[model samples]
Target: MFGKILIANRGEIVCRVIRTARKLGVRTVAVYSDADVRALHVEMADEAVHIGPSPVGESYLRGDRIIAAALATSAQAIHPGYGFLSENPDFVDQVTAAGLVFIGPSAASIRAMGLKDAAKRLMEKAGVPVVPGYHGEAQEIVLLASKAREVGYPVLIKARAGGGGKGMRRVDHPDDFSEALSGARREAKAAFGDDRVLVEKYVDKPRHIEVQVFGDNFGNAVHLYERDCSAQRRHQKVIEEVPAPGMTPALRKAMTEAAVKAAKAINYSGAGTIEFIADASGGLKPDRFWFMEMNTRLQVEHPVTEMVTGVDLVEWQLRVASGEKLPKTQGEIALAGHAFEARIYAEDAAKGFLPATGMLHHLQFPDAPPQGAAMRIETGVRAGDAISPFYDPMIAKLVVHAKDRTTALGALHDALARTEVAGSTVNMAFLAALAADADFAAGDVDTGLIGRHQDALVAVAAPSDEAIAAAALAATDAGAPGRAADPWSSLAGYAHFHTLARRTRLRFGEENILARVSARPDGRFQVALEAPHDAINSHDLRNLLRTARWPGHVTVFEGAVGYTFAVPDPLAKADEAAAATGSLRAPMPGLVKLVRAAAGDAVIKGQPLLILEAMKMEHTIAAPHDGVIAEIATEGAQVSDGTVLVRFEDGQG
Candidate 1:
């Protein structure tokens, strides 16, 4: 085994690689950009190297800087974890020319699968089943439109070099094909610097099923069963599971063999995934599955496969890169039980799942299942860390396993319900709701599951009366420094000769609530809700506040939800409210990518006025209503949240 390896990545994947390297007694080196100077992975590695600035192009994507860092640290190998330079074929060649091992497939294999159109052609030539589509090299718009018509309406316009749903669009008719193609090409160029695209027939009720395949230097390869990544949003996976819930023995056998064959076709080495899109309109069938694409590196959801097969994928990567033979033959590998992985992202599900950034003042997870229990959390952030806009907003991956799918899914729900996060908005509530979703629990999932049930899934439930009272009590307790020692000193509106009820006013969102508190003779406090419909009686405040912290603001986690409440100062409410009107504000800090309208341009409601790119995703700022634009921010300008992007004329509607 190599004595040391450099992890050319950041976030959880970097930490993940380091963990396995440490377990094998291999020293690990980590490379970081300016934004990740204090990142968790940097703190965990045996050695760290500074590459460049915060922007990925200046740092993470700088293959030269990464190679130099590895050479300086004497790293015998470099592990490109999942993203950044992981699948870049040129980067792989650079690493190999530097006389260091690249702990993944060869550059040739990556090139074979890098472009979607070319990869599909290769798969077809290799006798691997492929979807019916246009995989030709022609790029003319008219030719592409004709191909879409040939494939029938509802064709998919996809960037040949895209992943993560960045440059993909589904056109339902010929009327929309031109616009869809233009948008897909633009996004593809912006994201991957490649404007080439392919048109494919859209599969109805599709299920995303991928097989984890590994190969070694000796031409030996094996499959690690499969993961069902059908639950997706915006074409990106949300939840994944191993030993697909409805998979049959015959179907699993056929798909696994096909995946292994695809791997062998490329003479693939190290860890890679062969993703297949199954036509689920008639349920999973041997002949209904077709090759989608092959990811030429470790996958984000590999843990689900690991949990079911009891194999260390990263360890296999290291061993294979070291020229070792396959760890185990295909016959020796076995699937034990069911496992599920839910990607926890720092995003607001209600707000179109836009990525969010903030300090993590509080973060907690349920205790891992006792020793052998099938539960694990893979994360790179801790309390006090910040989720910046410079990188992916993933918070963590929650994996759970059990003897059966039902049991494992139940555990998933319980785990999500027990997780807590504060100091920023998160999709925890949405995740919990999804775990408990009847259709999801029943395993009737597809790419459109979230969209079909979006209203309920993204609905933010108002905090209960008990929860509000708990927050009030916690807030008052936080304001009193001597409450722990002298309970009476914490009392508000208390008299020397007479007893009176004390009320605390608090603001949660836009509603203000009055909480009445009284000191009981038994030394317990009773909190009553006085607004938003009064509670009939007071409830004892003993354990309602599971965890409370006051750092500039009050945050309390009660009943599996974290609520941040601000005390009304009666001083700045008017100013704050007045500053938030008659303008389009940037929802989050980001770079202005495009300003669609000039000052004084007349626009209709919902008209696209500008585009803001943040966290690597484009968001359109639309005109709130029919109005004349009075002012607009310039394109290419960096703006903070609440910075006015456009202001409308008064009564313009």
Candidate 2:
């Protein structure tokens, strides 16, 4: 094995590679940009090198800088952890040209499988079932429309060079084809620098099943069963599992064989994944699966596969890259217990799952597992780390394993419920809802499940009265003079005969919750809430008063309410404002990639006026009302949160 290798990536994946390399006694060198000087991966590596500025184009995407860092560090090989330069064929060639081993597939193999159109054609020739689509080079808009009509409506237009769901559009009718094509082309060009696209028939119920394939220099290859990645949002996978639910033995065998064939046909080596779009309209069958695309590097959800198969894929990658044959043959490999991976991202589910950026004030995963069993929490960020706008906003990969799929799902649900995060919005509640969904429980899922039940999926969980009281109690500052010096001064904890009453309101959704608290002679308190629906909930806060987080916004315990007291200084209250009347803008840092309207330009309500590219995705800024653009702020520039992109004139005819 190589003594030292450079990890040409960042974030959790870089941290992931470093962990494996450390176990194998291989030294790791981490490359970071300006924004990542204090990143977790940098701290985790044996050595670190500063590459360039904050923007990816200025650093991570610069192959020359990465190669120089590796050579300077005397690294023997470079592991292009998935994303950035992972699938870039030219970068692979450059690494090998420098006489350094590239710890992934060869340039030839990446070229063969990088482009969707070309890879689909290759899969078809290799007898691996491929979806019926037009993989032609015809760029004529009219011709593309005709092909969509030929294939039928509800077709998928995918960028030939795209991954991670960018540059993909689903056309439901001929009229929408032109707009989708234009949007897909623009996004593809921006994301992959490849505007070429391929049209494919959209499966009614698509279940993303991908086979994990490994190959060696000795021309031997094997499949590590499959992972069901059907739980997705915005075409991005949210949850994945190994030993797909409802998978038959016969079907698994066929997929494994086909996956091996696909690997050998391309002379594919190292760790890769052959993603198949399975037709779920009919139950999973050997014949209903078709090749979608192949990921030419280690996948983000590889942990689930590792957990179930008892195989460390990273170890295999190191071994194979060192010219060793795979340890096991196809017949030798065996399936084991089920495993699941839920991708915890720093995103706002209520805001359309838009990637969010914030300093992690408090981040805690369950330290004590139920029954004291092992659980895996793979993350690269620590408390006080900021989720930068330069890369993916994924917080961590939470993986769980059990004897059966049902048990695994149950464990995952419990884990999510116990997970706690503060200081920023996240999708934890949404993930919990997904775990509890009946369809997911029954192993029935599709790409559109999230879109179907979005309202219920992203709903903020209701905190019981007891829970609220607990939160209030947790929020109470024990150090306060009023609470410490006089227990009766604290609401719901009066030691005197006549109890004091206190009122507090909390924000839930767009509404405020009015709650009244009454102190008891004992340490406990009673909370009464009057809601808009004329509903009243009287909660007991005995346990909450004794055990609650210190100075919290709110807390829920069982079905009861808890209230903590933090009597803010009147001086501080005078200095705080409830609302701002200034213009609203992007909430996080980002680059202003597009300016849709000029100053004095008339715009209607909800009209798109600008686009900000942050966290590897584009977000549009819309007009608040029908008005002329009064001011356009900082076009084509990097901006922090609340940096206005466009301002509207006051109401006037």
Candidate 3:
């Protein structure tokens, strides 16, 4: 094995590579952007180098800078971990040209499968079952529409050059085809710099099952079973499992063989996944699946596959890249157990699952897996790290394994319920909801599972009456009566020995929790809370505040959501009334891409105003109501959250 290698990536994947490399006695050189100067990956590597600015285009994607860093650090090879330059064939070629090994598939192999349309044609020739679609090189929009018509309704227009759900649009009717194609082409150009697309017949109720395959330089390849990635949101997988639910032994054998065949066709080396879209209505069958795409690198959910296969794919990547054959043949590989992986992302599930960014003030997970369970965590960040906007918003991959699919799912559900994270919004509750979902538990899942049960997925437990009372009382700075901080309880009223009854209502979602609090003999307040149904649950505020321990703030973590109550010193509210209020705010911090309406333009509800790009996605803000635009502040400018872009007469709030 080589003495050192460079990890040409960032976030959790970079950290993942570094760990495996270190275990194999290979020192890792990490390349970071300006935003990641003190990131977890940088701190964990043997050596680190600054590539460029925070933006991926300026840093991680700069092949020349990455190559220079690798050479300067004397790295013998470079591992591009699944994104940025991972599938860039030109970058792979450049790395080999510089006398450094690219720890992935050969550049020729990548080029063969880089474009979706071309790859499908190649698969068909390789005897692998491919989706029935138009893979032809027709550029005319009318011709493409005709092909879609030929393929039947509900055709999928997908970018030929990129993945990660970008530049992909599903049109269910001919009337929506033109507008969707335009949007898909625009996004494809922006993301992959390629406007070329392919039209495919959209498979209804498809289950995403992908096989993990490995090969050596000697043309030997073996498959490591399959992973069911059917639990998805916005076309991106949120949950994945190995030894796919409802998979039959015959189906598994066929998919594995097909995956190995696809690998052999490309002379594929190292770790690659051949993803298949299967019709799961009748359960997995040998003849019911078709090739979707191939991920040319280690997948994010590889841990789940590792748990069931007893294989360390990263170690295999290193061995294959170093001219060694795969450790095992297809006959020797066997699935051991069932495994599940849930992607914990810093995102708001209710607001369309928009990515969130914040400091991780408090992050905690179960110290050990449940008895007889294999709970694994693969993360690049720790407490005190900031979730930056310049990268993917995933916090970690939580994997669980057990003797059976049912047991593994049960363990995953319990694990999610016990996991706690503060200071930032997360999809933990949503993930728990998904695990407990009836269809999901029954292995009846599809791409539309989350969309169909979206409301229940985002339903948070309402704070109980006692919890709300405790939060209100905790918000008051006075300590409990007879405690050190509440010694002046008898003199609270000043004129006489009296108690002040403070009433405060906290709003979460659409429910209002009412609290009536009074200071006791000690500084602590005796609080009583009432819910809408006259249900009362009393909470002792003493322990809740102490356990949360936020800096100058009290956050009551009860039920499903956290309630943030300020412990102000009575003067903080006076300072809030003096601020100006006419600013039209940006809902998120992002770069202003376009300004549709100028000043004084009449705008109606749902009228597009401007576009903002964040976390590799574009969002357009619209007018909340029918109003006349009074001022247009910024156009094509980078702005922070709540930065004003335009102002309207009655929509200022």
TM per candidate comes to 0.95, 0.89, 0.90
Writing each residue's lDDT as its tens digit, candidate 2 over 1-653 gives 99999999999988888989999999999999999999999999999999999888999999999999999999999999889999999999999999999999999999999999989999999999999889988889988888999998799999999598888899999988997898788778889998989999999998899999999988999999999999999889999998887889888888889999999999999999999988888888999999999999999999998887888999899999988899898788788788889988888887788887877766667775533233688898987888877778888888888888888887887677666665556778788888888888888888888889889888765555555454444444322235534554655434355765556655544555565666544544555556532222233334323332323243232311122233343244454644233344776677787787888898888888887776646677887777887777666698886676665665432
Q: lDDT per residue, candidate 3, 351-464, as tens digits?
A: 778888888777777788966799988888888888887888898889999999889988897677566666667888788889889999998888889999999988876655
Q: What tens-digit string does per-residue lDDT give for candidate 1 at 36-130?
A: 99999999999999999998999999999999999999999999998889999999999999999999999999999999999998899888899
Q: What's the lDDT of the predicted structure labeled candidate 1?
A: 0.85
In order of lDDT, best first, we have 1, 3, 2
- Compared with the true structure, the alpha-carbon lDDT of candidate 3 equals 0.81
Q: Going through the candidates in order, what is the number of backbone clashes in each?
A: 0, 24, 10
Deviating ranges (above 4 Å) for candidate 1: 370-372, 478-493, 499-503, 535-545, 558-560, 569-580, 651-653
Residue 136, candidate 2: how far off, in angstroms? 1.9
- Relative to the true structure, how large is the alpha-carbon lDDT of every model? 0.85, 0.80, 0.81
Poorly placed runs, candidate 2 (over 4 Å): 370-374, 478-521, 525-539, 542-584, 595-606, 623-629, 632-637, 651-653
